[model samples]
Target: MFEKKVNIYNVFELRCKTTCYFGVGAIDKMRDISEYLSKRGMKKVIVVTDPVAYKVTGAWDVVTKYFNQFGIEYVLYDKVTPNPTVEQIDEATKLGKEFGAQVVFGIGGGSPIDTAKSVAVLLEYEGKTGAELYEGKFTPEKAKPIIAINTTHGTGTEVDRFAVASILEKEYKPAIAYDCIYPLFSIDDPQLMVTLPYKQTLYTTIDALNHITEASTTLARNPYSILLAKETVRLIATYLPQALSNPNDLNARYWLLYASAIAGISFDNGLLHFTHALEHPLSAVKPDLAHGLGLAMLLPAVVKEIYPFVAEILAEVYEPIVPGLEGKPGEAEKIAKGIEDWLFNMGITEKLESVGFNEGHVEKLTELAMTTPSLGLLLSVAPIKAEKEVIARIYRNSLKRM
Candidate 1:
């Protein structure tokens, strides 16, 4: 659907070197990792997770069984919460160090995996706190190896070098990107996702959709990244509804997981734009809000704000969702409206105000967005060059009741 001709002479660098195992029973590959670790003389591993969800889903039993059979000792650090905080990372890091862990295993959603990334780097730093990492004060030459088992199809933290942690005291969520933090390997098992609640399935799918959309349109877009983005968008548009409607559909679940990984790889190369920059502050301030929900609430407004500059690419993004709209007049508006209608159908019809993001919070959110380090990256890669005023207006627009 993306029919535009790209410049063949453009130079780009891509570095997705993580070995990924993707399928219905990918978790079984833990034996391979166990053997790899045994060869390295690494005996202790720290598993970072959300305890309740892991236990409820039986992923804990499955993972531990594999490790136990391999004679690998592990310490469970299950304090990771949604929108993980600097404090959580610090606590996990302390536990990891105390356990004398040689490897870190992240076994949940983005929050746990991100916490593990910080822990992996902090394990080598000795005295460094997560606050120092959040502030970008220290860069590590090497990090303890990380094994990321993705239980959700969102936030490709499994394959990405980027880790997002919220500093609640500062009311800021800064994304830390370092090469050393990339997972040594990752497993994508759709069996792990069949038990996911429909709401979570919906939200995580939307998050993956945003990743594909943003990655394809950013200034960093290369032919390889765009190829991944287009396929990711197509997969999500086709299979997400099936996964939500029939949670037991393994095929749908498998594709969604694949989409999440490819989108992660795509965005890692192409980067993201204004939607992520805007949503981070919302989650940072609220702490309880899910990242995908914030993106769903804000994406329509962001699409509208940047439409004039990215009409062609936006239309291309929407083609997967609404066929035959790529070359039409007013295609961008059609794309935005299609997304809004899809969200409504998915029961994500609430606005920012429904999530406690009212006009009163606008000024504070705007200030945080303006100050966020990712704002510059977003603006630089955005199809449109947005200023502080434009960012503020987009926030205000998102606050209106749907």
Candidate 2:
């Protein structure tokens, strides 16, 4: 048993903006969603999705079937790719504006859902570009309502208020968090997630784990964050391996999806620090690198450095997967190594070197992290102060596993 640290004196608030429908057969809620849109006179919807996931997961059939039945008019923007770019959001927004879209429906994982959040904002603030949105030039108070149809068990984008996008010209990736961007409705049906490829299954699960790890220990952490983080890690530890071994195991998928949602809500309130802030720069520099893979590579180094500041909370949060890590003040190195070895055994074996990053790239990556619009905010909440040297060291240590 482990004690979850909570300070009663700290002021904190918990809120969830999205109305989420979750479970094994939750995809059928699409019909109810369509009817609600119809009643609200939000019949013109633009769907943002990746080309592959929607069709392969049978979400396309279910969504379209309901849209047709409800007399909903929709346009498809299926070109969203991983690490979605400003160009993608602008293109989707243009199409939506032209089609007189009243609602934004994002289907698939983080990229498409995040793109939909940007598109929703852009459509409401007509004439604004994705670059401008991500650059923080506009502080949007409201946007067209978004409906997130999640097809993956990771990326709590379906239930959170944060969105990320890349500005390729400057090689910058930044995130935006707004009260208005939370999905008006969300559907998390594990049945739709059954077809997730093996690598994605692992990568997305890592992403959720990182979310809780950072959220539970950030300066903004509260009772809500710590409580949810513990449950999130326990669920992932138990269900992820089962889901990996039996892809069609709906029970495993359901719990993983549930975990992802709570993790998203946890971070929505508690916020994140090193892993997410640093990973953004890596993925920005190497667009092909999956976001979760970048975080996994950097996580151990981050844990090793910040463990002293957040030892008790993180130890409790990770105890489910990496046991007996509590109350060891001088065991940061051991704890980090344990996490690295566990992730490796779970199938994430490549290091920064495998992605072509080296000592030469560390300076550039650090600069990007410091200057990226909203990344600095995330860095500010880290338990350890992230000076250039500290940031550079983490990158260097991650070059190859210790």
Task: Report the lDDT tens digits of candidate 1 across residue range 1-402.
Answer: 231242212212223678877777777778888888877889899999986667766677777887887789999999899999889999999998999999999989899999999999999998999988887787777899999888999888888888999988888888888899999988888888889998899899889888877888788888777888778888888888899889988878877887898899989998988899889999999998989999998888887777667666667667777666655445556666777877888778878988887788888888888786546666678767767787888888787633
Q: Which candidate ranks first by TM-score, i.e. highest?
A: 2
Can you give the lDDT of residue 150 in candidate 1? 87
Mark the regions of model 2 whose C-alpha exceeds 4 Å error after superposition.
1-15
Q: Which stretches of candidate 1 lie above 4 Å from their native place?
A: 1-15, 326-330
Clashes of 2: 0
Each prediction's RMSD to truth: 5.4, 5.1
Highest lDDT, which number?
Answer: 2
Give the TM-score (vs. native) of candidate 2.
Answer: 0.95
After the best TM-score superposition of candidate 2, give how far the Cα of residue 384 lies from its true spot, in angstroms. 1.5
Residue 93 local lDDT, model 2 = 96
Q: What is candidate 1's CA lDDT for residue 307?
A: 69
